[model samples]
Target: MWNHTEVTKKLSIKFPIIQAGMAGGITTPELVAAVSNAGGLGMLGAGYMTPEQLESDIQKIIKLTSKPFGVNLFVPENPVVIQEEIERANQLLEPIRQRLGIKKKSHLPQINTSVFDEQIQIVLKYEVPVCSFTFGIPPRETIHQLKKNGIVTIGTATTVKEAIMNEEAGMDMVVVQGSEAGGHRGSFAEPFDDSMIGTMALIPQVADHVSIPIIAAGGIMDGRGVFAALILGAEAVQMGTAFVTCVESGANELHKKAILNGTEEQTVITSAFSGKPARGLKNEFIVKMKEHEDSLPAYPIQNMLTQDIRSEAAKQKKSEWMSLWCGQNPRLSKHLHAAELIEMITNQIEEIINKFHLIKETERLI
Candidate 1:
């Protein structure tokens, strides 16, 4: 069975599938519990949540299922430098804000301090089984604390160098996130442009060099992807886009619909929605914001500025204004229950392995 792999045994899951911790309410307790109950490691996206909110959500997940689940946090960076360029970027957004009938406000909202410290405390207090971090690896002291408390640590990497750093930092595993991943690019050591390694290419290389297990991510939409990743030396596969359409996912209806109707060409990597480069189904906001791309503020800041518009768009069911994140082959996604999808993917991988064995046996006699 697929659970015989090192990752499955280590994570105590029946399959090597990990539901990605896609933040901004997509990775709800319902979805996480559903995936965990289905034998895959469901991850809770705890980056945007406050310490109190995270504790409440974790308690809810415990009530829902006894299975182990992971929580992902965004590693905070140095303080963002404020400049007049941010003002210029706001000037650019004026037109679209007007179109949405949003009233102009006097002062810009205060930049939020990263809640990484507070969130991690909650994880340790609650004894979360696994914890993953994006944007960058956690400090050695933090990693030590988590490991001391019996938590499995995972760090996201976009390049082989980043993976090496993770291994050096004592990460239990590394999530090798390919460029085709939706939402945010987890690259931290280098610029986003230099870290566009695809899943197939990135996995084997990271696998070749790192002693720790590699969790392959990005553009993996089906069982074939899961099988391929394993063959490339990945211990498991992490999927986000595939689960977005699942009934248990917390993605808004319009966001789900946009993904369901989208073409591969419809999605583009843009920093418009958030300051960091992220892929999403392209819309009016992306197109209009392109001219001002040079002036946009850094992440958390840019993300804050656009929050109101995105919320209003979701409320109005306007696809053009909502952020619909998905992978390169989102059209391949199916509308199914979380358990049903997990079962289907498991079957496909099993069948593929069987067919491979049959082919190898036939070839030996030739």
Candidate 2:
């Protein structure tokens, strides 16, 4: 019989282990399929792809696994979308442009949730079971539409206040993203900074306040992290850095090798790559970003300026300039199949449960 937590029973997932959505190159169809088929929930990262590309990937994932999976989208915060950052970032990159062998962006760039309504519409049309949003919450209507189709909604938050807002916006669940998380910081207000709360502090408080289900994320790696989160009231745990090392992931060889070769001390938060604070591996680009934080444009501008550089770095195996996102617990990673990885976690969680019971039994005997 399947021992399902409330989350597992609700979603029909076997375990409460959810593969965190790593946008861009990490969360591929192969990775998502392997995870969901193995009895955990998997979410497809659709942040950087075109809608058609997203459709293709979703189809591929479905073909690979009959089990239910999900998709994640990034919601840009209000005010500036993509252009302000692009134009500003291009100007900032004038000096590096000469050396990078790329001409300056000739046209004035403008970016806003491109085909935003259409993408949400597609999510409904396809009847994807679960959809997650980050950076900011989607419009009220967007949330209502997804709910109407019975899509499970999750929002990411780095702080408790943001998690409250997610609940108010009617999210089915909220991912409590700690400071130690990789890739982008999911802060929705003010700016990203180390509020300094670890996963332990962040998870429980968010759980206490929100009526919706809470999913814990950050530096969680093994059974201990899973055990801790469950005790703290998280219905499930969302993990990213650990999955990046899995054989089923789409992370480049260099990227996977970097994670395998990393340490707790190797990770640092820098705004150089995207103009938003994010945890990643230490490299030359990261160093420069820290040194020139004041010089960079805001957000997507900084993100756009470095996009091509990151692309080239991936192609050439230049780990120094790439946005090699990672978490604090990366040193403990195992290079294994996605299915086997979840199984390892299951063994650990079961051991913890059994030991607790044994201790209780001894107490009764005494």
Candidate 3:
């Protein structure tokens, strides 16, 4: 009964658990299908994928499973490009690139303003079951178009005001990403630093403000976190760090190892890798860039400049220069099959419920 909620009915999934759609190759087709087949919703992190790449992955997922899956896209941002800033960021990263033996310089990033639109068309063409947006809410027309096609639209938010914006835009559900969330901060309405509310506090506040279903994300790693979110007024939970170490995850081995071996105090939020603030293990690159983070070009720009360093570092087995994105609850991470992870969480939830019921029965007898 705990797993049965509005999210389950609307998403048409057996369990209320949804794997966080982590971009940068973490949510592979196999992982997505495995999660969906295991009774929870699996999502493809298509934010960084090309339109063609998105279509190809969708086809692959279709062959792997008939169960419903979701695709997450990053809402396009139009930051003012500063050539001077780009040069400075590149200058700061040159030493790392040299250390990794990367000979070629990274070119200026090309901003694809129409990529989101093209991705939407792909989703419509394939009739994907669910589409979620991060960084910001999509246009009202975009939400309307997705809803018109019967595709569930979920928006990410870090504050109550952002949740209300998603509802006004007609989002079917809103994922309130707490400050404890890994990867990029989905705080679009205000400065991310001011929007860093924890999952426990953000869920109930957003629930009180918005009538749409709330999917709590951030520091949610197991059944205890899931049950806690539901009790905090969330209809469901989205987990990222818990899935990053799964066997099916496409994350780099070193990245997985860093998280597995990482402690709760090791992770920090930095915008050096990408023009946006994200939580990950503090490494040499992060430390070197800390002083210059505020001066770097806005995301996608800064993200482009550091691409070579991250890629080469991974190839050379140097995690010190790589981005090991993780949440505050890294100690709870486990390496297992996606299905096994789902089953474990489910069993844990069931045991917790049974224990509570036993307690209630004993109290009644007394």
Candidate whose lDDT is highest: 3
TM-score to native of every candidate shown: 0.95, 0.91, 0.97
Rank the candidate models, highest TM-score first. 3, 1, 2
**How accurate locally, in lDDT, is each candidate?**
0.88, 0.81, 0.92
Candidate 3 per-residue lDDT, tens place, 74-171, comes to 99998999989888787888888888889868568689879999999999999999999999988899999999999999999999999999999999
Look at candidate 1 and give me any clashing residue pairs.
none
| Tens digit per residue, CA lDDT, model 2, 210-240 | 8888888998888888768888888888999
> By the TM-score metric, which is better: model 1 or model 3?
3
After aligning candidate 3 to the native by TM-score, how far in Å is the CA of 214 from where it should be?
0.3
lDDT of 1 by residue, 11-57 (tens): 89889999999999998899999999999999999988888889999
The C-alpha stretches of model 3 lying farther than 4 A from their native spots are 358-366
Cα error of candidate 2 at position 33, Å: 0.7
- For residue 95, what is the lDDT in candidate 1? 77
Best by TM-score: 3
Error of 3 at 124 (Å): 0.4
Mark the regions of model 2 whose C-alpha exceeds 4 Å error after superposition.
Answer: 1-3, 78-109, 357-366
Question: lDDT of candidate 3?
Answer: 0.92
